[model samples]
Target: MDDDRERLTSKPETSDPLPKAEHPWVETLKTIGLSVVLALGVRSFVADSRYIPSGSMLPTLQINDRLIIDKLSYRFSDPVRGDIVVFHPPAQLERELVANGEKKFQEAFIKRVIGMPGDRVEVKGGKVYINGKVLAENYLGEPPRYQWSSTELTPDGIVPPSHYLVLGDNRNNSYDSHYWGFVPQDKVIGKAILRFWPINRAGGITPQPDYNN
Candidate 1:
């Protein structure tokens, strides 16, 4: 039976030889290309990861702390106070960076939302007040010590429509909306869902506030 089976399968003639090497390489290339595309699509639309770069979010997020962001959430619900977020640098901050000749990763910055759209916020006497109430920022390593200067966004400001006032939990150290401006809704990339770095601190991030709207 083995001899008969071997005789039944004939080799290709010289005139009709198959291009064996090319087919394997082409298939491998196509597979690799598809995999890359799929990965990028998932990262852009489904979810992505980021690491804490500064002490702004200290006490909550430490430098080099990695996070998994939920890019899908903001599509359905708006950001709320207390939720940690990742967003592209606002235009004002970007311009300042360029003018100063600084070279930093031009990626998004992460911070905790302090005020939602239309909320009145003021930082004075070393405290952050939102909607006439001081933010109970238990996550801070210390009370906000830096006063928001006139050049900053305080002195009782109203958050613009489709924007949010975000600050680092490390209020005194973070360069956030206080130094720039509100994070436009369009520039928001996602909600910080979990922290998966530094081993012992592996857990969910600060929960999002329950907003009526």
Candidate 2:
């Protein structure tokens, strides 16, 4: 009887083995959540892609052209003339757009840097002159069809420190700095570096060739 009692009282062998397969749905949801978080983080802090929605950069960037913007490089260096960039519109321009029935105002403007801070800029007689030198801009899909009659906008004034002047390739009709004002250096988001969509034009986006040389 004592032997029987000892055998019966012996602690049952512990069988706490973890399940071989985790709850399948729980793992799937976790994986999806992680993927989404990683994608958003990369987009916000690394690089971002945007689609060209207008002809402002025609012949170079077409409508629906997919571009990969280099958000990282600008952190190490300031924008240079000829670098294509995307930036937020100035506050006054935003207000104007909203008041003009564009309640859901478009996000940002893309243009090429034509002048940097402290540089003199002038546009007259169908040519853009920088610091008294006529800039040779051959990238314009079409010639600048409008002449600036305003003295304040003439290449006469020096670009403000920490500001840049930009213009679209489609100079004749683009709603850009010429229509508004300078893009503050800090407002610049990133330089456009590549055209990844529309297959035919997929390649490295070129900065305007240096004209100073």
Candidate 3:
């Protein structure tokens, strides 16, 4: 009777063991890693944030204004006129920077598209002319203080294929297409869709100008 009771009470032995509880530190590290990966993925392929550091886009985008750049839309379609774009400096600008002793010159720029492929662009008498018609830009706080001839950037003033002419709303202050050259389609990072900083000014970026009218 005693032997039978002991055999029934004894625990069974097996090769398999119960899983050990994960260490709290290990769990924390895993969570952090996953968060970082997700953030990077979203920033690289989905959307990202940028802050304006200059007045190039002033009256439209103020200095230090935070913007959400849409990285996915241009994947399905080409950029159009009036889109506020952020892009890496073009080769021409990069070369100029290097010649001027700028060793690290991979800065990005933000500007509004003013001319598309094969479009004629010119700036004279404080007004921008596209295809010989004056561009009705009501967003400018003031008229451009400089002049840019059509042939200055390219022969015949036509924007080359896969290239875009971009300018700042603060045209005279911006070092842009008129100074360096056109931005290649591939250099564009994305378009600025919304401004989310400075509560009072927070809203979608300036509406796209109507070119058809």
Candidate 4:
């Protein structure tokens, strides 16, 4: 009976609650803080979101289409032909006109890389031929599309070293390399890799092929 009584009186073993589980508020704040940091990191380094503002890149990128730009690519290698990219305007343009009367230097524009350094690009008879070979473009939407005016390089316009010549998929509306000039390599901001908005139309964009050069 004494042994039974002693055993009953002895304290039972118990586990301390899980390492003082963090307070709900503290956990919530930590999660929020981490998310903000991650977002900023993505915006600055990995990827960023942008909206199409004009018809310049139409057929492939429509007006108001939201896209996710891949910021990690150019860090390791140079952009290639047919990769759609975003870049700043050239310096020769009038600042006031380019900024559109805005106070800040708004220089971001999106277009497809049609020519790279040392490439010979030309438009003839409504078709784009590079280095004497015709290019196959499967992205242009319909049969009634307006092809840009045929123009040939008066002189061999070598794509400047470390620069790319870009064009809008909508040949008639875009103000791209044909109108202005090549985009300096340093000015390329990123590549538009995916379209994430509008649930019904969400998918990755396949970069166009470049014929053997």
Candidate 5:
């Protein structure tokens, strides 16, 4: 009778270790599920992870400054004047032009929109004149006077009926519309919505107030 009771108590101890071996697979599945969730989150929001690559938008956006470009907002409406945009260079035009018909690779540029379709654009006394009126820009770090050529656009050069003209805030140092031309509506990727990374500079990028509309 004493031996029979001891045998029954030892049976439970052997069974308990079997379930511990099964837990590894359950933990692996949990880790995989979390990874999928993170990937989906990045795709949905404007990723708060981009860096400025050039000095074209210097006074406002600096090189190496990480930014958050909004990919959703522009889906509801077209880009407006004074909006800073990122886009691929217009096809066929290059950083350098050929003497006859040569092609060169011009990296994409970033700049602010000063004119749009159906609007006349001009620059005088370092001031931008749109539709026979002067535009007030309080964001420029310096007046644009001696750096750019006096540009005039005819009805045909006026943004191709669906395009936009853009320029850098640092006019003298930027190579923008004064060189290549207008940005095609389809080439526009997204708007620069905010500055991130540098905790001190993290904030929303307010859209330039619209006086033309």
Candidate 6:
């Protein structure tokens, strides 16, 4: 009877075991993967960084200058004149490259918006004109050395709907719309918002004061 009592009072040794702790390395890998995914998501839809690779935007963006590109703004509104923008090569340029037998690749180009839909753009006598009025440009490195007329560059003497004329601040040296053609609205990637590198010159890329006057 005492033995029976002892067996009744004792806990069973065959009870279920506690769950095993996960390996430390397994947890570490999970954290790393989550961080990578978050970074990629932000770059794709929120904002991203870019560095100037040439003097095309000189005096405004020097070679090797790093900038923050805002990819969200254009989704809410259309790009306006004087906004620095980055975009993919347009179809016209792609066809030319293909004709030259060059390697096919997508590269982003940076330039400032100069003409909007329905606007007439003309470059002559060291000045840019929009709709017959001379543009007030205080940021150009120097006057454009080349001449361009809307009638000569486009099918009509005005910017087509959903197209933008882009040019480099370093007008004389840039390979821009005057050389190739208009940038389709859909090809634009984003507006350049800030310069973050070369700390002495770091600041917002402010839009030029309204030149429509």
Full-model lDDT for every candidate: 0.81, 0.81, 0.90, 0.77, 0.71, 0.90
Q: Give the least accurate 10-residue stretch of model 4, judged by summed lDDT.
A: 142-151
Residue 103 lDDT in candidate 4: 54
The TM-scores of all predictions, comma-separated, are: 0.78, 0.84, 0.88, 0.76, 0.71, 0.86
Q: Model 1: per-residue lDDT, tens digit, 58-131?
A: 88888899999999999999988898989998788888788889778567888899888878877777777766
Q: Give the clash total for candidate 6.
A: 0
Best by TM-score: 3
> Alpha-carbon error at 86 in model 2, in Å?
1.0
Q: Looking at model 6, which ten-residue stretch has the lowest summed lDDT?
A: 204-213
Give the alpha carbon lDDT tens digit for every residue of 1-213 in model 6: 999999999999898889898899999999999999999999999999999999989888999999999999999999999999999999888877777787855489999999999999999999999988888888877898778898877677788999999999999898788878899999999999999998999999755835546
The CA lDDT at 55 in model 1 is 79
Query: Candidate 3: what lDDT?
Result: 0.90
Clashing pairs in 4: none
Give the Cα error of residue 117 in candidate 2, in Å: 0.7
Which runs of model 1 end up more than 4 angstroms from their true locations? 1-30, 103-105, 149-156, 208-213
State residue 45's C-alpha deviation in candidate 1, in Å: 0.6
- Model 3, residue 73: distance off in Å is 0.9
* True-structure Cα RMSD, model 3: 4.1
lDDT of each residue in 167-197, candidate 4, tens digit only: 8888776677776677888888999998887
Better of 1 and 4 by TM-score: 1
